[model samples]
Target: MIARIAMLFVAAAPLALAACATPAGEYPSLAQREIERVGMVMTPPQTTPAPPPNPTEPVLSQARELVESVRTAHAAFLASESAVRSRVAAARGATAGSDAWALAEVALAGLSTQRSRAMVALADLDRLFIAASTSGESTETIGEARSEAADMVAAEDAVLSELSAQLAS
Candidate 1:
Protein backbone atom coordinates (compact mmCIF):
# COMPACT_ATOMS: atom_id res chain seq x y z
CA MET A 1 0.00 0.00 0.00
CA ILE A 2 2.84 2.36 0.77
CA ALA A 3 4.48 1.56 -2.58
CA ARG A 4 1.23 2.21 -4.39
CA ILE A 5 0.74 5.54 -2.67
CA ALA A 6 4.27 6.55 -3.53
CA MET A 7 3.55 5.79 -7.16
CA LEU A 8 0.32 7.81 -7.05
CA PHE A 9 2.12 10.76 -5.56
CA VAL A 10 4.83 10.53 -8.18
CA ALA A 11 2.27 10.42 -10.91
CA ALA A 12 0.36 13.43 -9.64
CA ALA A 13 3.26 15.64 -8.71
CA PRO A 14 3.93 17.11 -12.14
CA LEU A 15 0.37 18.24 -12.47
CA ALA A 16 0.51 19.73 -9.01
CA LEU A 17 3.66 21.61 -9.90
CA ALA A 18 2.17 22.76 -13.16
CA ALA A 19 -0.75 24.28 -11.28
CA CYS A 20 1.71 26.37 -9.30
CA ALA A 21 2.80 28.11 -12.49
CA THR A 22 0.81 31.34 -12.34
CA PRO A 23 2.54 33.55 -14.86
CA ALA A 24 4.34 30.37 -16.02
CA GLY A 25 7.26 31.77 -18.02
CA GLU A 26 8.42 35.03 -19.50
CA TYR A 27 5.08 36.42 -20.58
CA PRO A 28 5.26 40.17 -21.06
CA SER A 29 3.35 42.27 -18.60
CA LEU A 30 1.59 45.12 -20.39
CA ALA A 31 4.26 47.47 -19.09
CA GLN A 32 7.17 45.28 -20.17
CA ARG A 33 5.52 45.11 -23.54
CA GLU A 34 5.38 48.88 -23.68
CA ILE A 35 8.92 49.37 -22.39
CA GLU A 36 10.26 46.82 -24.79
CA ARG A 37 8.22 48.59 -27.42
CA VAL A 38 10.09 51.80 -26.74
CA GLY A 39 13.69 50.77 -25.85
CA MET A 40 14.32 49.03 -29.18
CA VAL A 41 14.03 52.03 -31.45
CA MET A 42 17.28 53.83 -30.75
CA THR A 43 17.57 54.20 -34.50
CA PRO A 44 15.95 57.21 -36.10
CA PRO A 45 13.24 56.49 -38.62
CA GLN A 46 13.22 57.72 -42.22
CA THR A 47 9.70 59.09 -41.86
CA THR A 48 7.31 60.03 -39.07
CA PRO A 49 4.02 58.15 -38.73
CA ALA A 50 0.57 59.70 -38.44
CA PRO A 51 -0.95 60.54 -35.05
CA PRO A 52 -1.74 57.69 -32.69
CA PRO A 53 -5.03 57.07 -30.90
CA ASN A 54 -3.32 57.69 -27.58
CA PRO A 55 -0.87 60.53 -27.73
CA THR A 56 0.35 59.42 -24.34
CA GLU A 57 1.63 56.15 -25.76
CA PRO A 58 2.47 55.56 -29.35
CA VAL A 59 1.77 51.90 -30.09
CA LEU A 60 5.51 51.46 -30.28
CA SER A 61 8.54 53.29 -31.60
CA GLN A 62 8.52 52.36 -35.26
CA ALA A 63 12.07 51.01 -35.52
CA ARG A 64 11.92 49.32 -32.14
CA GLU A 65 8.51 47.97 -32.95
CA LEU A 66 9.87 46.56 -36.16
CA VAL A 67 12.78 44.90 -34.35
CA GLU A 68 10.62 43.40 -31.59
CA SER A 69 7.91 42.34 -33.97
CA VAL A 70 10.64 40.24 -35.51
CA ARG A 71 12.37 39.15 -32.32
CA THR A 72 10.02 38.40 -29.38
CA ALA A 73 7.56 35.74 -30.45
CA HIS A 74 10.23 33.33 -29.23
CA ALA A 75 9.03 33.94 -25.65
CA ALA A 76 6.71 30.96 -25.60
CA PHE A 77 9.39 28.64 -26.93
CA LEU A 78 12.13 29.90 -24.65
CA ALA A 79 9.87 30.03 -21.63
CA SER A 80 8.65 26.46 -22.06
CA GLU A 81 12.19 25.23 -22.39
CA SER A 82 13.16 27.19 -19.29
CA ALA A 83 10.26 25.67 -17.36
CA VAL A 84 11.16 22.15 -18.45
CA ARG A 85 14.78 22.58 -17.43
CA SER A 86 13.72 23.74 -14.01
CA ARG A 87 11.28 20.86 -13.68
CA VAL A 88 13.83 18.30 -14.78
CA ALA A 89 16.39 19.65 -12.37
CA ALA A 90 13.82 19.57 -9.62
CA ALA A 91 12.88 15.99 -10.44
CA ARG A 92 16.47 14.87 -11.06
CA GLY A 93 16.23 11.68 -9.08
CA ALA A 94 12.96 10.47 -10.56
CA THR A 95 12.79 7.38 -12.73
CA ALA A 96 12.84 7.89 -16.49
CA GLY A 97 9.32 6.50 -16.56
CA SER A 98 8.01 9.10 -14.11
CA ASP A 99 5.05 11.29 -15.03
CA ALA A 100 6.95 14.43 -14.15
CA TRP A 101 9.58 13.80 -16.80
CA ALA A 102 6.90 12.96 -19.34
CA LEU A 103 5.02 16.15 -18.57
CA ALA A 104 8.16 18.19 -19.11
CA GLU A 105 8.78 16.41 -22.38
CA VAL A 106 5.25 17.15 -23.53
CA ALA A 107 5.58 20.81 -22.69
CA LEU A 108 8.87 20.99 -24.56
CA ALA A 109 7.32 19.49 -27.66
CA GLY A 110 4.37 21.88 -27.51
CA LEU A 111 6.85 24.72 -27.87
CA SER A 112 8.65 23.31 -30.92
CA THR A 113 6.62 25.07 -33.57
CA GLN A 114 6.91 28.36 -31.80
CA ARG A 115 10.65 27.90 -31.80
CA SER A 116 10.69 27.21 -35.51
CA ARG A 117 8.59 30.28 -36.21
CA ALA A 118 10.92 32.42 -34.13
CA MET A 119 13.95 31.11 -35.98
CA VAL A 120 12.37 31.93 -39.30
CA ALA A 121 11.55 35.41 -38.09
CA LEU A 122 15.09 35.92 -36.90
CA ALA A 123 16.47 34.79 -40.22
CA ASP A 124 14.12 37.09 -42.08
CA LEU A 125 15.04 39.96 -39.80
CA ASP A 126 18.72 39.36 -40.42
CA ARG A 127 18.18 39.33 -44.14
CA LEU A 128 16.22 42.58 -44.02
CA PHE A 129 18.93 44.29 -42.01
CA ILE A 130 21.81 43.35 -44.28
CA ALA A 131 21.45 46.55 -46.31
CA ALA A 132 20.04 48.61 -43.47
CA SER A 133 22.35 51.59 -44.00
CA THR A 134 20.57 54.84 -44.74
CA SER A 135 22.09 57.54 -46.97
CA GLY A 136 22.02 60.27 -44.31
CA GLU A 137 23.67 58.14 -41.63
CA SER A 138 27.46 58.10 -41.46
CA THR A 139 29.07 54.70 -41.98
CA GLU A 140 30.21 54.68 -38.34
CA THR A 141 26.69 55.39 -37.17
CA ILE A 142 25.23 52.55 -39.22
CA GLY A 143 28.05 50.23 -38.16
CA GLU A 144 27.51 50.96 -34.50
CA ALA A 145 23.79 50.30 -34.73
CA ARG A 146 24.32 47.08 -36.63
CA SER A 147 26.87 46.01 -34.04
CA GLU A 148 24.35 46.64 -31.31
CA ALA A 149 21.73 44.64 -33.17
CA ALA A 150 24.21 41.85 -33.66
CA ASP A 151 24.82 41.80 -29.94
CA MET A 152 21.14 41.52 -29.28
CA VAL A 153 20.84 38.67 -31.77
CA ALA A 154 23.77 36.86 -30.22
CA ALA A 155 22.27 37.12 -26.74
CA GLU A 156 18.96 35.81 -27.99
CA ASP A 157 20.70 32.99 -29.80
CA ALA A 158 22.47 31.97 -26.62
CA VAL A 159 19.16 31.74 -24.78
CA LEU A 160 17.68 29.70 -27.58
CA SER A 161 20.62 27.34 -27.52
CA GLU A 162 20.27 26.72 -23.79
CA LEU A 163 16.59 26.11 -24.26
CA SER A 164 17.30 23.67 -27.06
CA ALA A 165 19.72 21.76 -24.86
CA GLN A 166 17.19 21.44 -22.06
CA LEU A 167 14.64 20.13 -24.50
CA ALA A 168 17.13 17.70 -25.94
CA SER A 169 18.11 16.34 -22.56
Candidate 2:
Protein backbone atom coordinates (compact mmCIF):
# COMPACT_ATOMS: atom_id res chain seq x y z
CA MET A 1 0.00 0.00 0.00
CA ILE A 2 2.79 2.55 0.83
CA ALA A 3 4.59 1.97 -2.53
CA ARG A 4 1.37 2.41 -4.46
CA ILE A 5 0.66 5.74 -2.71
CA ALA A 6 4.13 7.11 -3.52
CA MET A 7 3.72 6.29 -7.24
CA LEU A 8 0.36 8.07 -7.38
CA PHE A 9 1.82 11.19 -5.64
CA VAL A 10 4.67 11.42 -8.21
CA ALA A 11 2.26 11.17 -11.16
CA ALA A 12 -0.12 13.92 -9.86
CA ALA A 13 2.59 16.51 -8.90
CA PRO A 14 3.58 17.49 -12.47
CA LEU A 15 -0.08 17.77 -13.57
CA ALA A 16 -0.95 20.04 -10.60
CA LEU A 17 1.98 22.43 -11.35
CA ALA A 18 1.16 22.62 -15.07
CA ALA A 19 -2.44 23.60 -14.32
CA CYS A 20 -1.44 26.36 -11.83
CA ALA A 21 -0.12 29.15 -14.18
CA THR A 22 -2.55 31.34 -16.16
CA PRO A 23 -1.68 33.36 -19.31
CA ALA A 24 -1.96 36.64 -17.34
CA GLY A 25 0.69 35.53 -14.79
CA GLU A 26 3.17 34.35 -17.46
CA TYR A 27 4.29 38.02 -17.95
CA PRO A 28 2.22 40.12 -15.56
CA SER A 29 3.47 43.63 -16.48
CA LEU A 30 3.60 42.86 -20.21
CA ALA A 31 0.11 41.30 -20.22
CA GLN A 32 -1.44 44.30 -18.44
CA ARG A 33 0.46 46.72 -20.73
CA GLU A 34 -0.68 44.84 -23.80
CA ILE A 35 -4.31 45.00 -22.65
CA GLU A 36 -4.06 48.73 -21.95
CA ARG A 37 -2.36 49.33 -25.31
CA VAL A 38 -5.17 47.50 -27.11
CA GLY A 39 -7.79 49.39 -25.13
CA MET A 40 -6.14 52.70 -26.13
CA VAL A 41 -6.12 51.72 -29.81
CA MET A 42 -9.74 50.51 -29.82
CA THR A 43 -12.66 52.81 -30.77
CA PRO A 44 -16.34 52.58 -31.51
CA PRO A 45 -17.30 52.79 -35.18
CA GLN A 46 -17.65 56.37 -36.49
CA THR A 47 -19.13 56.15 -39.97
CA THR A 48 -22.46 54.50 -40.81
CA PRO A 49 -23.31 54.13 -44.48
CA ALA A 50 -26.97 54.71 -45.11
CA PRO A 51 -29.14 52.01 -46.66
CA PRO A 52 -30.45 52.66 -50.20
CA PRO A 53 -33.80 54.41 -50.42
CA ASN A 54 -36.65 52.78 -52.33
CA PRO A 55 -36.34 52.95 -56.12
CA THR A 56 -38.88 55.32 -57.71
CA GLU A 57 -38.14 54.89 -61.39
CA PRO A 58 -41.05 52.66 -62.39
CA VAL A 59 -43.82 53.45 -59.91
CA LEU A 60 -45.57 56.79 -59.74
CA SER A 61 -45.46 58.88 -56.56
CA GLN A 62 -47.18 57.24 -53.57
CA ALA A 63 -49.83 59.95 -53.64
CA ARG A 64 -50.51 59.44 -57.34
CA GLU A 65 -50.88 55.68 -56.92
CA LEU A 66 -53.29 56.12 -54.02
CA VAL A 67 -55.44 58.53 -55.98
CA GLU A 68 -55.40 56.33 -59.05
CA SER A 69 -56.32 53.21 -57.07
CA VAL A 70 -59.17 55.02 -55.35
CA ARG A 71 -60.40 56.40 -58.64
CA THR A 72 -60.37 52.93 -60.16
CA ALA A 73 -62.27 51.53 -57.20
CA HIS A 74 -64.76 54.37 -57.43
CA ALA A 75 -65.53 53.46 -61.03
CA ALA A 76 -66.04 49.84 -60.01
CA PHE A 77 -68.44 50.89 -57.23
CA LEU A 78 -70.44 52.98 -59.71
CA ALA A 79 -70.85 49.97 -61.92
CA SER A 80 -71.95 47.87 -58.96
CA GLU A 81 -74.48 50.51 -57.89
CA SER A 82 -75.93 50.57 -61.37
CA ALA A 83 -76.20 46.79 -61.36
CA VAL A 84 -77.94 46.87 -57.96
CA ARG A 85 -80.33 49.48 -59.27
CA SER A 86 -81.20 47.31 -62.24
CA ARG A 87 -81.70 44.25 -60.09
CA VAL A 88 -84.06 46.18 -57.75
CA ALA A 89 -85.95 47.50 -60.74
CA ALA A 90 -86.69 43.91 -61.78
CA ALA A 91 -87.99 42.98 -58.30
CA ARG A 92 -90.14 45.46 -56.41
CA GLY A 93 -89.49 46.05 -52.63
CA ALA A 94 -85.83 45.10 -53.07
CA THR A 95 -84.07 45.91 -49.80
CA ALA A 96 -81.19 48.33 -49.39
CA GLY A 97 -78.02 47.52 -47.37
CA SER A 98 -77.58 43.97 -48.53
CA ASP A 99 -74.13 42.42 -48.00
CA ALA A 100 -73.05 43.48 -51.45
CA TRP A 101 -74.48 46.95 -50.96
CA ALA A 102 -72.75 47.29 -47.60
CA LEU A 103 -69.46 46.29 -49.14
CA ALA A 104 -69.93 48.85 -51.84
CA GLU A 105 -70.77 51.51 -49.26
CA VAL A 106 -67.71 50.82 -47.15
CA ALA A 107 -65.41 50.74 -50.12
CA LEU A 108 -66.83 53.86 -51.68
CA ALA A 109 -66.87 55.90 -48.46
CA GLY A 110 -63.48 54.79 -47.18
CA LEU A 111 -61.78 55.05 -50.54
CA SER A 112 -63.44 58.40 -51.19
CA THR A 113 -61.76 59.90 -48.14
CA GLN A 114 -58.52 58.23 -49.08
CA ARG A 115 -58.77 59.50 -52.64
CA SER A 116 -59.45 63.03 -51.54
CA ARG A 117 -56.51 63.08 -49.17
CA ALA A 118 -54.31 61.45 -51.75
CA MET A 119 -55.44 63.90 -54.39
CA VAL A 120 -54.34 66.76 -52.16
CA ALA A 121 -51.04 65.04 -51.54
CA LEU A 122 -50.60 64.44 -55.27
CA ALA A 123 -51.23 68.11 -55.94
CA ASP A 124 -48.44 69.00 -53.54
CA LEU A 125 -46.14 66.44 -55.12
CA ASP A 126 -46.94 67.79 -58.59
CA ARG A 127 -46.08 71.27 -57.43
CA LEU A 128 -42.80 70.01 -56.08
CA PHE A 129 -42.12 68.03 -59.24
CA ILE A 130 -42.91 71.05 -61.35
CA ALA A 131 -40.65 73.27 -59.30
CA ALA A 132 -37.85 70.77 -59.52
CA SER A 133 -38.33 70.45 -63.28
CA THR A 134 -38.39 74.18 -63.82
CA SER A 135 -34.96 74.56 -62.30
CA GLY A 136 -33.59 72.59 -65.29
CA GLU A 137 -36.16 72.94 -68.09
CA SER A 138 -38.41 75.25 -70.11
CA THR A 139 -41.61 76.92 -68.77
CA GLU A 140 -43.77 75.48 -71.61
CA THR A 141 -42.87 71.91 -70.65
CA ILE A 142 -43.62 72.54 -66.97
CA GLY A 143 -46.98 74.14 -67.85
CA GLU A 144 -48.02 71.13 -69.90
CA ALA A 145 -47.13 68.74 -67.11
CA ARG A 146 -48.97 70.88 -64.56
CA SER A 147 -52.09 70.97 -66.72
CA GLU A 148 -52.09 67.20 -67.15
CA ALA A 149 -51.80 66.69 -63.40
CA ALA A 150 -54.64 69.15 -62.75
CA ASP A 151 -56.92 67.33 -65.18
CA MET A 152 -56.20 63.98 -63.52
CA VAL A 153 -56.84 65.46 -60.09
CA ALA A 154 -60.15 66.98 -61.23
CA ALA A 155 -61.33 63.68 -62.67
CA GLU A 156 -60.49 61.84 -59.47
CA ASP A 157 -62.40 64.35 -57.35
CA ALA A 158 -65.46 64.27 -59.55
CA VAL A 159 -65.69 60.49 -59.61
CA LEU A 160 -65.03 60.21 -55.88
CA SER A 161 -67.89 62.57 -54.98
CA GLU A 162 -70.33 60.84 -57.30
CA LEU A 163 -69.51 57.46 -55.78
CA SER A 164 -69.69 58.93 -52.29
CA ALA A 165 -73.25 60.15 -52.85
CA GLN A 166 -74.21 56.69 -54.12
CA LEU A 167 -72.82 55.14 -50.95
CA ALA A 168 -74.86 57.53 -48.82
CA SER A 169 -78.03 56.71 -50.73
So what's the TM-score on candidate 1? 0.38
lDDT by residue (54-102, candidate 1, tens digit) is 4212312333443454356555555665666676565555566688767
* Cα lDDT, all candidates: 0.55, 0.55
| TM-score of each candidate structure, all chains considered together | 0.38, 0.34
The number of clashing residue pairs in model 1 is: 0
1-169, model 2: which lDDT tens digit per residue?
Answer: 9999999999999999999867875564643565477557777689988996643332235435544554554455445455444433343332456765565655555545545654564566566566546655334543444455566556756766665555455
lDDT for position 148 in model 2: 57
Model 2: lDDT of residue 47 = 92
User: Candidate 1 — which residues are off by over 4 angstroms?
Assistant: 1-66, 74-82, 95-97, 131-169
Candidate 2 ranges beyond 4 A from true positions: 1-101, 109-121, 129-137
Tally clashing residue pairs in candidate 2.
0
